[model samples]
Target: MTDFAVSYFGGRVSLRFAKGVPFAIAALVIAVIVVGITSLLAGSYDLAVWDIPALLSGQGDKTALTVLWDLRMPRFVAACLVGGLLAVSGALLQGATRNPLADPSLVGVSQGASFAVVSLIVLWPNVSIWARPIAAFAGGVCAAMLIQWLSAGKRGENSLRFILVGIGVAAIISAGTSALLTYGQINRASSALGWMAGSVHTASWGPCAVLAICAALCLPALIWVVRPLTALRFGSELAIGFGLPVGRAKFGVITLAVAMAAFAVAAAGPIGFVGLLAPQMAQRLTRAGVGAHLILSALGGAVLVSAADLLGRTIAAPIQFPAGLVSAVVGVPIFVLLILKRANSSQL
Candidate 1:
């Protein structure tokens, strides 16, 4: 009713309102509506977006319901689920690692899955589609395990030195992947490039099922580890000071983070930045403080991934880049801002 309040309300939406909870919820609701409409309307054979609700509820025509049930719906669910996982995994990894730069990709999970998948695709040209996800999943697990073993020091003491080891492994695997592509195998390279770029636009429900299963299995495990994760924020000495199981807890969280990251990459093909951006974006949203609130970060991640997918499909029209590419492009600016914030002040 006041002139100042009216002016403030009319001028712009406040993104920082009360840890931005209201806006985040609004953003999520809007994202869901947008994604649902876009998925129903997208592709060469477009359908009326408004008709989707009837189709989903089995009240529509056979053809419309079939299209929604068989193809568009799967792609829609896959995009949101994988996106949510990638983003939340990023948030979890960063919280546990206590490094802004730490991500599944930075820790070697993406490269591991990428290397395994590309190698299998290139070598076993006879392999079936059903086998690819399995191979990628196996590769991801192997990568996480390798990093854990190499990073473990005497008595399992934790240090940034483990990150250094993971970085080295990532670099080595990355170079090897490059070599596979550089051997004048254009078709193999193209496929590998596509996988590395990451997309859920063409995803079938099978890969989504793999990711969803991981979420079902790993999320509760992550929750169980949450208390120790909070303890970790105060540093190992402080954690030990509070009668927490310092070495074991940190190692467990770290392992869970790696597994989640690896499984995500297998499901969606080495998607990056979601892990880094999701938590940072959520932090800006929460402004309440640092650390993971799993469900909120998941929603934020899902929103981000779906928005990026919509942009990827719509912005270029007939040609679309990977959703992962869009996340990287969007995330770079966020990382820069975080760096600048850290330089100017030490709060993050």
Candidate 2:
């Protein structure tokens, strides 16, 4: 049991872990390593597994080093970060909204980011690439606020009402994206479309670092909000009675969720279903509370996206599928299964 123990907040708090968690986390780590190696070795130019150690040590074949370090590594790292961020974002949103179906992709956050990125790309072609993330973040905030307003959060939380509003917001944003694509120049349209499909094909160290830094900065805030979130789960009245700042905590959690989603969208466009899938999978695998759920969700997200990206690249050889397409392909069935399970459990 001690072996499975994990600490949070500089050991000020201790949360017990399940007996199987260590094994599960270890398995996930191994899976990530395997995927990273596969990504490094199985690209357009294949390299021997033995060569990887040499490449890291600066003694491998020049071509192998170039392929591994410059091209594949950034993408591998980016995919991991994007997946983790998206999953954690989903966890936060699910907690904040008290809705299992709440996810960035479903609730208009990703669509809003997509719309913002496309609008800037088309309407303000002269804007710098660095500005896209900011715009996407702003768009995500707007989307969240719109959802809250439409759902009338001032009255109280209603899962069904919130989800319906999110769907409406997503539809409006999607329509705007389509209109931009419909009338924009062919060249710009194609580029936006590819980005929106969630390709990590052009991954580079700069964007990868950006994603890492953003996660690093947001993590402390997440930790701070976790306890409050757990309290909020009992209801705002109980949360307030417990001395939790319900409104501030809700804002913090939602803002963190939106920011994480925006970062993922900025890095790899709107990779569908990772945000939706990760937290749900994490929840199913563990009975631990919010903190553990968040960590596990991040790990699960990393695995799902990395595996999806690797499969996308290898399944069709020279012709590649975007991770988003793969996630959507895989996620639809999982989504249906979740819905059915929820319904059945409720019936019981």
Candidate 3:
């Protein structure tokens, strides 16, 4: 294979590794492991770090195994899964739409999912929990289609135009969600609020299984659309001229992305900014090609969510904060800096 090098952040980086592994990717993987291990060990119950391996091997104390295997493990795995899914969803959206601010939450997909779930809970209280993911996926797909239709034009889809329209759609959906809560009984509203707040504190095997199955089903579709998504970054005209079925491919990408986000919302309640932060951070850290960027973005998202959940767990001790709150708290400053940098570089 040939080697490619790029200079980023005033430093020269080389992509000359064997077996197609980049240095940045290796670093991200290591970071994810470190974060995962820390999350496994730093919960409310003080489990000895060394006991984890023994517990996995069926030799640890009953109490330690119960804490590690029963309580913390599910949440840990769910955080990683939800984080990766959200980040990949964001990468696909940003790549397909060429929008710097494209994210599941910001672009109305998450809000749409939230609105659907909230509405279901308020209006159809007897609906099984298993059906919530389907509702969320439907809502997200509708929002994505609406955005596409609203943004279509002779000059092709514009990034800023899509962002503006998505923001409007999100706000409207959010308002509707609020109205549902306002009209519904207090108990149902409170339950819905907790889900919307986005915590993995209640993580259990069922939700984890559902998320894993969704990923298993979506992975092949994601792989199929990668080429078209990469081509799209170069512009729709060139993509169409290159014999790509731009319309069909773009629709497939949007659907795949929205489904992933919707599943994450169903599993973890609309955790915001994993999609936004993960892709940009991955790009800056690696500067590799689109494929590498996608993988790194997924890893980065996993690390961010795991780390944030861990922080929320330990920061207030005995009163855990929702991961969504921590994500917004952390994401807001990074978002501001991104906006400032883009403005200074005239990319905004």
Candidate 1 backbone clash number: 1
Best by lDDT: 2
Per-candidate TM-score against the hidden true structure:
0.79, 0.92, 0.91
| Ranking of predictions according to lDDT | 2, 3, 1
Q: Tell me the TM-score of model 2.
A: 0.92
List lDDT for all candidates, in order.
Answer: 0.70, 0.86, 0.85
* Shift in Å, residue 246, candidate 1: 2.2
User: In candidate 3, what are the lDDT values of residues 50-168, reduced to their tens digit?
Assistant: 87788878787888887777778888889989999999999999998887778999889999999999988888879999889999999999988887887676775667667778889
- Which prediction has more favorable TM-score, 2 or 3? 2
Per-residue lDDT for 277 in model 3? Answer: 98
Model 2: lDDT equals 0.86
Task: Give one digit per residue, the lDDT tens place, for model 1 in 221-328.
Answer: 875786787787787788899999976786677667666766666667777777777776666665432323555667777777777877888788878878888988
Candidate 2 Cα misplacement greater than 4 A, ranges: 1-15, 153-155, 340-348
Q: Residue 310 error for model 1, in Å? A: 1.3
Query: With candidate 3 superimposed using the best TM-score fit, by how many Å does residue 15's alpha carbon deviate from the native?
Result: 14
Residue pairs with backbone overlap in model 3: none
Full ranking by TM-score = 2, 3, 1
**Which pairs of residues clash in candidate 2, taking residues 3 or more apart in a chain or in different chains?**
none
